[model samples]
Target: AGVSQEFDLSQCVREPIHLLGGVQSYGALVAARRGDAVVDTVSRNAAGVLGRAARDLLGRPVTELIGQEQWDRARESAEAVDVDVDAGADPAATDSGAVARQDGPASSGVLPMTLEGVDGPRLFDVTVHRTGDLLVLEFEPRAEGGPFVFQNFYPRVRRALQKLQGASDVTECCAAAVREIRALTGYDRVVAYRFDGRDGPGQVIAEDRSEGREPWLDLWFPATDIPPQARRLYARNWIRVIGDVDDRTAGLVPERRADTGEPLDLSASVLRTVSGYHLEYLRNIGVASSMSVSLLHEGELWGLIACHGDEPRRLSPEVRAACEFFGIALSLQLAAVAGREEADELARSRRSLASVLARLTSGASDDWMRPGSGLVELLDADGAVLLRGTETVEAGAPLPEALPGLLANLARRGAVGEVWSSDRLPEVLGLEPEEAEAQGVPAGLLLLPFNRDGDLLAWWRHERPAPREWAADPSRPVRTGPGGERLTPRGSAAVYRATVRGRSAAWSPAQRVVAAELWREVSGLLTRQVVALEARNT
Candidate 1:
């Protein structure tokens, strides 16, 4: 048997990075101010550009750093930008006054400003968002190419979107998106990682890499790699970049305000530094710099577009914006592809089910138990059993005599729903290994309820020794070192095999869809049959 360990709640909720309480770790310069616009804290990077240390900048006014003239120009730019913006705003934006009133901009807003650099005054793009009573600002030096050069990339973005729209499936769309993004951003590798569920493991579904790189396609990463809080942050902040992992992080001078003794909330700031554990994890993976664009589906985080570089690499704001645009386009395409595939699968299932219904209505005795019309074939199961009151009809492999009673007890205990499925029946049903083996019972079951009196259809699958190929040993979820037990990413990219036992092939989304539709049709038929029998008796 594969190694198993107890679940740790701490791994899921631990958020050391969020506690840092400042955006000083971001690649660009950052500062936070009170509602009255007094600078509360500034990053070391911003202090360097201003030719002042962090201690000198603390408790100063924003005007002092940008100069009074540039500050006025920035306010004007912000007002103009606000007017041009529509009601559909970015989710990361917040205004202190509006937040106090329980409403505001959906996300941070950007303003064009000029700031004093070591050499001379330089163009900077400033983004501002409110967190609690503080207004956080991020500053990035505007590239020399300017808006004109950034606008030039639009055609390429449009082309990529068009190609994605043309993709017939999710796999093709992801592959195309990664290739296009890697080419646009000049990253060494790009991968589309999709979460299995809200807090489940993530799998590298698609990837594209530069020459001589190892592929991460089909690799699965545990949920502990990205804790719940980090996921929440990702959903709020769509784009995150680590320009250089080796770069030193600059801490806030005071760390907290003298008056309030409260730390600044940098949740929406791009300059927020990640946790040391995450930095170590990335370092272990040999990634010097990386960027991630959150892939959202219906306003929820569905996955991420991960870009990894072997050396320190910085993407201009223009390029990062382009990647974000592509991520949005890819998200839409993924939803469309899934919808189309489900529709096609439903059609096929209806056709197959219709044939079975026709036979049932023809008054053919035992037709319900026949091979093609039986519940087994309808759900693509290895075997099936239908329980109607005291009557039981079975096909394929025989079920254990105790199975029906076990299912009935489950329904009474609220374990049954419209449809209940389990790949490992022994674990789910609490059967000992020896007991399950002695009965020669299958390891998978799907129960579809028909009525309240325990009348249901059960599909069964024989134990299949399916081998899983993992990028590393999944059994050993974490490693211990002198620094203590850390949830590090697997060091080895080589394949590790483990044969899954006491379990059958996993059920797919399409199969579940078919089972649901079949249940509805069968329930209606059973209701009609009962009505006819009651009428005859009367």
Candidate 2:
């Protein structure tokens, strides 16, 4: 048999990312300083408004770049804030403070300065941070439209929050969020892409788009689309923009850090250049410009608010700040909606289980593991089997002959949880897919152990073929390239079918909760039954 050399593009999700190099193509001008002197700089031509190329600014005193008065104020502000950046700490931990304070009040700590522009002196809003031995300065132009633009911006954010507050569920809130974000940024399309779990695939749950465009609603993208390192950058930065995909990126004058001899840490940089692979991926998807705002829940990346444009577009600093604010507001609303939904579902399941427990305690001759019983209904499984000592009672789908040995081995290896479940039993049990299918075993299995001997209750579900619609055929994920093989984004936007095998319907959160509650109740019942038998013998 010939082993195919075709590259699995999905493996790109595990590829290592170098985050701290290259200057971003965006407009923000960046320069590194040590004490009161500039060591290196990277500026766009548009930054000529600041009056010098990156090379000319190098080896110059900071006082010459910005007036002496402005430089002094920046130093004073840094000392007043007493910001600390631990070099050895995780980048994520060190960068959180900057992301958290990005949306603070305009006057809170902004260092206002006047730099010599090509025309004359122009005002700029500068933010300073200490990264290891370097003082990184990021400069943004003052709004030409003035402070009123910001005053109006805050009200719009308030209105978006009010709309979210009125939403009754997670879906409704996500829909409202995409709409509001599109309206605020004027993007051609806005989508709320949520991850299934950590390192899981993402799905476009809600979308708002311009007329005459195909919608990406409900479309799923593989986890490899955004690699782990990219996800880490999203968590640290919270907001990123590609002003124009075709624009060339500028490079830092000195590529390596002066002290560490490693790449400059750009984790907190607003002007960090994106990876070439990511840029190509966007081009394949037909996006000209893009912006992403991270939606973090409980310090973990839950999803993203993605904005795309058909034409090159750039958001002003103020506008980008507003988008970030909207993302924060939306994250809070999503958490509220999910918490409420989970609570409501758990409550319903608890009520149902309580009724079953009452009947069981009243000497009712009910087999809880049988079809239509509370345990079966609670877990939402098609069938269940109860194994007590040497006796076995099966209901719904027939129990497989090999299940007992498999369960015993799993328990011995500590591979099974207190209440373990899997939609694809073949993968979890290390069985060959073909052999699993041939054995006539159900695709789904849930085990609840009742004793150290591996005696337990088992729930089973027959295989159910679920057809997934993808933007392109996922099996052929990569294309042959001039340089051996390289990962490429799915080129076709047309819907493609993929039939999922070796799996059954997933167990819902509500079902899991009910299973845990039923386990406790059943264990108590078994204990009581054993006590009664001993009393009779005595």
Candidate 3:
């Protein structure tokens, strides 16, 4: 793995510049300071040219080399003055003829300097700019080849692949991917944002944050934030790379086509400008630059891998290509892993249900059918009741007289019971005729009835979801003052969305499918468990 290291550029401005299509080692060096202090004097090729021998230049004040003549000239100018130098020349030779670039007015001061290297010669163009208590020196190199374009990310990519292979579970795999992306890109924060819509909103379900940062771990935003239209557009566009969120928008170049009148295909156009809405979102999130890759599962939108940077960053074409490849591989692995886990759970549930049923089909009495509680346990339900409506008998005298009728009606309809207060249920037990209509209790309570050889051996009843106020204002009401100053709790829809309905949970397609499948499986399992238990009793 490649580790990123930062050095104090207070020394100098040095960077590697290589040719695009050619092989060449080119670098630049510059020296600068603040208030007569020798802050930075370094070169990228220092080791190659000066090496340890280059130490001679350190701690030397700029006024020394110029003597009186050039010093006066520099003190008057207060601006950068490029001077040609030959390292081979004698120090005492006036022919050494160096021009001093001053950053102040005459008589103010001058930074006198010379550059020497062990190598035959190196050409540098330096400019000096002064800020409050700080001097900046920029070095521009004149070289045969262009500056170096960083490439060869194979090592980082290889390590990421290895980690992916070693991941034990889905969360770990995603976390590994996020970590690798962040590490590979040198981004401030990289997150694996899975799209979850359960509560009418899309949100981040999982994230692995970098150290020393606030967590966007489980944060959710409204679907309107990334509208369906926007998502569709993003899918068509493939990906987006924002260089600087605060930067001015560049003009969108009208793409030319072979036929003059033919409209350009924005789908494949990388130059299509980003929308203002998206830019605002990025700014709100504190991301200066970002790269988002769409994750697809089963040919549908799965989620995205969002790489965020605290500072503006631009990825080279090669780096972008590498990221795409890595993202695709990760998405495939994630989907496959999730599928396998789901299959395993289903298989386990089926096995448990089969065992429970084996005992019931033997004509076992209700007491022997007790172990069928295993069915409820496997189903993850609060409780399970086997109601043989045709043969049900009330054992407790205090029980409602109409209890059997209510249970029988519920059995007629297929419903999975959820939690609900007694008040929410209709008075199907016929406590009061008028009250039953008003309460609208058991139109038919949720029931899970399984058949045993054409006989209704037992049925399961589940409560309904508890009623809760969707949203409540948090502010306290206050009376108006003399100047009409007042405060009051105005109900907020946003709060309701976040708290009551749990928008994300309510809108999740994946969760819904999972719930439906679980219900169907439990129904079949209950039949088997009850029959098996009855057989054991016999």
Clashes of each: 9, 0, 56
Q: Output the better candidate (1/3) by lDDT.
A: 1
TM-score to true structure, per model: 0.80, 0.82, 0.47
Error of 2 at 224 (Å): 2.2
Off by over 4 Å in 1: 1-13, 24-35, 51-106, 116-119, 147-149, 253-262, 298-300, 364-366, 400-402, 412-417, 422-443, 463-466, 481-493, 500-510, 528-538
Model 1 per-residue lDDT at 448: 77
Q: Report the lDDT tens digits of candidate 2 across residue range 1-538.
A: 1134766554554433443356555444555564655755555443454667776666777676776677667656654553222221233533322222222211112466777766887776666655554556666667676532578688888888888899998878999999988988899989899986666667788999999778789877766677766776576546788878887776665666566575656655656677777777778778898999988777678899898899988776667778877777887888888888889988888888887676656664345554666666666677777767877777766677666557666545333236777888886767765678887666888777887876677787777876767665556545666565544545226667776677878876777767767667777888888899999999
Q: Determine which window of 10 residues in candidate 3 has minimal summed lDDT.
A: 15-24
List the global CA lDDT of all models. Answer: 0.68, 0.68, 0.44
Cα deviation of 131 in candidate 3 (Å)? Answer: 51
Residue 99, candidate 3: alpha-carbon lDDT: 17
C-alpha positional error of residue 480 in candidate 3 after TM-score superposition, expressed in Å: 24
Model 3 C-alpha lDDT versus the unseen true structure: 0.44
TM-score of 2: 0.82
Report the error of model 1 at residue 116, Å: 4.2
Candidate 3 wrongly placed segments (more than 4 Å):
1-151, 198-212, 233-238, 247-265, 364-373, 383-538
- Candidate that would win on TM-score: 2
